[model samples]
Target: MLSIERTLLRLVMAALLIGAVSVSGTVYFATLEEFNEALDAELKHVATSLARYRDLSDASSAQRPAGTGRVAEPELEDSEIETFTRDAAGKLLYASDEKVRMPFIDSEGLTRVSVGGESWIVYTARHRVGYAQAAQRVDSRRAIARESATRILPPMLLLAMGIGGLLIYGLRLGLRPLDAAARDVAGRSARSLAPIDCTRLPAEITPMVQAINGLMARLDDSMTAQRRFLADAAHELRSPITALRLQLQLLDRSSDGAANAAARADLQQGVDRAQRLVEQLLQVARTEPEAQIAPMLPLDLGSIVREVVEAASAKAEAWQLDLGATLAEEVPVLGDRSQLLILLNNLVENALRHTPSGGVIDVGAEMRDGRPVLFVLDTGPGIPKAERERVFDRFYRGGQPARSGRAALGSGLGLAIVKAIAGQHGAVVELLDRVGEPGLEVRVSFPRR
Candidate 1:
């Protein structure tokens, strides 16, 4: 994995190094040019001094008059600067070295030439009678330039090193909050899901921190609900299992045929009830918000209602109630097929269990106000408006027995499971009174796509 810290440090270091090298190189070249100019000026001064006399000897040893306070002109040294003079017609009149004479340039300021296998700086000038020239060794002038330019390095190097050290330290200090956030996350256990401290955190990191906090908050809620569901499920299962065991014992101990037949019948009923409860519990778990479910697909609400009513027709008949469906022509919505089916089944099953024999039950799908709605209505005394919301709570058996005898899931898991499934599908479940009838209408409204 690529690390943010190392990449930042390397980029900054590279920029500093480049900047330092650029400054040092510019100073070196600028100093060298100035030094060369000073040396060339000195050469011009010497060449003009030679133009005053015909040859080098009188110009050097000639003394100023005895009473004059001024000193005699200084003699030119041949090793440092060679002097020469020529007439206008190119006849050599005075030569510092007679054997190796340098030819003059057509126009003069400064020029380099070869003399006796060494490079020389030769300056030439026009004189009243003839032109004079002076020369100096090129190697000598460059030696001075090199020494002066090199002095710039030590201070520049020290400054670069100091700046580099400061950069590394500043980077470490500036990035400390990100490291602290990582450690905070690493140190947390399942129970400790508090948000990370955002004080003094950089703006670039804020969005990522907020996202993590949101996920942890959701996880905390899921874990809490799961713990509660497990506790309630365990409590609900214990009574039925205990009753089944006692019924089995009663069947084993009964001596008369009539008593034995009654015990068997009661035991069968208890087993069937336990099976339904386990089924409902599984449905609730599958509909949990954290579940990894199949993607929801576009489906027809009418088609789903028809399927559920058809499947429950036999169950409804056995309970001595009328079961029917009324569906719109095109009630399309987005939903997970299996979960929506589970939602409808729970509502219908509870209705069948609670409604008196000969009562009416209707399932239907239709569009109202631009949303798909499914409804299950029973012609039995409906849940009071006050207790409608409470029925969605897990294992919420009513304070009094329902219309028929008791709730199918004790009317507990059935409605709770229905609510959980509807929430996952972004649907809402409502309990309303049937118009003019002493019954309940359980309506599930699905959002438009």
Candidate 2:
């Protein structure tokens, strides 16, 4: 379908043509009318003059020739009038010898006359003298005027046609830029996010060009971010996998029972590290937009934190470390319950792993600024101020373990998982010092959606 602007232009041009044709037709018809009126008047004047000549000849009893010379000494007529006469009742009384063989005068005031073997209109009128009438030729006058008009019509029609064609051509030429712009956009591929070249465009299209450029820049940024994330994830996963393979090869040698048992334990530890890395990778992938995770619903943040604390306490007991929790009554937030639980579990477990056998781990929640604020505080070596932000990155482990006497085996992705889950739930994670002491405190806040 044509757009409204094109359709409107078409209608306007059509109306212009109609107006032009109508005006031309009216002027043409009016010219013909004026010619007829003048012809009629001239015919009446000729008839009146002829009638006066006839009355003079009748009263003098002398035959006066229609085209007689100035000398009046003749006793006989030389040339007779080439005219026709009719009575008041329109009965033909006489006609010239040239028209004798043809019809003379008609009662309807319309009749043909033959003069020198050519046709003419013999228009008649009654004279004031008794019973006598006169007529004159009106044909030659009307024919000349009509012939002049016929000669002028063709050029005027040609001019109108030329003007209309030029208008259509000019309109199409003016819209060429718009057509070119459309083709430029449609020819691009889905992965092509380059800016368009609009250096020669008209001023009206400047805004459109700017808009397309802005969108392209944003798409390029998103693509670059995704590429960086993939590269980092691959680097993190590769180290553990390579170590596990080497450990497995050593376990294959069973030279001595004690040596074999030690090798087996080392191999099992390597396998465990690899498994944890893979799980964290999957969790990060799931948090992405393309993962198709369902929308979050209202869930109790406090209860979820308590559950993670209880689980971490069991692990702490096995390691001879103390685990404790101080959850507020009910800290409700809008989020996926399972994802929130996963986040809580990772944070508590991370604290327990870094703390020594005699160190303490505490989990708690409180309401702050109408938001649910959950924190995991541990009596372990805290992150340095310069490296605190870097710790949230995937596979980033702190330089020193919080436990003074021992080290914890970790794949270094637990805090990374906590950050991802918090981000998905529209929350923020912050690192702080626990009560201005030597321990680290991780605080997560989920907005009340």
Candidate 3:
């Protein structure tokens, strides 16, 4: 629900508003201070001017008699400066207003005084004969300061509004690239796993776009692999189903009891081969996924080889093949237990299926060069050097495994499954011709812990 654009816009406006308020408040206070300073200076000037009249009165009294000359005053307006004079003996000599008397002080300086219950800024001057005081009402002086300071608000408000407009325009223009990137991503479909345009994108957004493109690329690959597996499974299963139908028809047409019995046995063999192929296909499907998600646990490769040999011993005996395992005490490996089990089972069964009667299939696991190694060797006609690599490819049963047996040669997924599981566990599988023997040795080497 949160929008980046809206949040940025709000923050920009909020800062602008706060700045405007702060500037306006500072201007208002500064203007008020200057206005009050001018008023105080005016009060001092008027009080100093009144000193000339007191000196004139002293001259007249000296020429004639004491307390004879009256101090002449200016005809001041009621809102203008109010004047008062007192002699050195604290006697009122003259007053500008008969009712509104300003308080007079002995010292000469600016002062604040309450006269007739109203505050005034009064300035007193010490003279040769008396003191002269000039005062102005505080409320009237403050009104002038407020009026002068308020003139700034209209222009400031207008400027603030204009800048806000510019801010909105700038924000819209700056965010256009982000909108374009969003649109580019929004237009894609499931079939289009192509990457986003990173060329013009901001540095902050480039990494996220790359991560999304990577995920989509992986998904596309997984889907493609699944499709290929389905196609291969359908192609391989069709042959067995058709053969089953043909075998059933032949068994129904046969009249002799012995011929019918033979047909039934062959049909059963076909069923077994189909069943094994389906099972191996399922294992192939399960193994070809991303291996990082698998629950790989530490296990002994020796134990895996021994367990697989024991399970396949009866099957090997039924086919007249000798099955056995030679294992070390501990050969540690990290791998999915079930998948590893399937991998070993496939290698052992592949040998059992291809090795002829009276042939020995030797399974072994041990540590070599600080790495765990599992190998299966059989005394059967081995794979050709050229075909060894291709044998591990899906659905590629090597060109007529030259062994005489009815244990079913293979559905071709055995070594392929083995290679896949080993690869998932970071192991390398090699199809090497047995030394001093006529057989193949499938050796799998796992990375050292």
- lDDT ranking of the models: 3, 1, 2
Candidate number of the best TM-score: 1
Per-residue CA lDDT of candidate 2, range 174-228, in tens? 6677678778778876578777887877777768877987877877786775787
TM-score for all predictions?
Answer: 0.70, 0.58, 0.66
Question: Which 10 residues in a row give candidate 3 its minimum summed lDDT?
Answer: 62-71
Q: Where does model 1 exceed 4 Å of error?
A: 1-4, 22-160, 171-218, 406-411
Error in Å for residue 22 of model 2 = 16
lDDT string for model 3 (123-153, tens) is: 8987888777887888876665566557766
**Any runs in candidate 3 off by more than 4 Å, and if so which?**
14-213, 290-294, 399-408, 433-438
**Best of the two (1, 2) by lDDT:** 1
In TM-score terms, candidate 1 sits at 0.70
Runs of candidate 2 exceeding 4 Å displacement: 1-194, 197-215, 398-408
Colliding residue pairs in candidate 1:
none
- The C-alpha lDDT values of all candidates are 0.78, 0.67, 0.79
| Residue-by-residue lDDT tens digits, candidate 1, 284-375 | 77877666877889999888888899999998888889999987679998889988888898888888888889999999999999989999
TM-score of 3: 0.66
Model 2 scores worst on lDDT over the 10 consecutive residues at: 71-80
- RMSD of each candidate relative to the true structure: 7.0, 11.7, 6.8
Give the Cα-based TM-score of candidate 2 against the true structure: 0.58
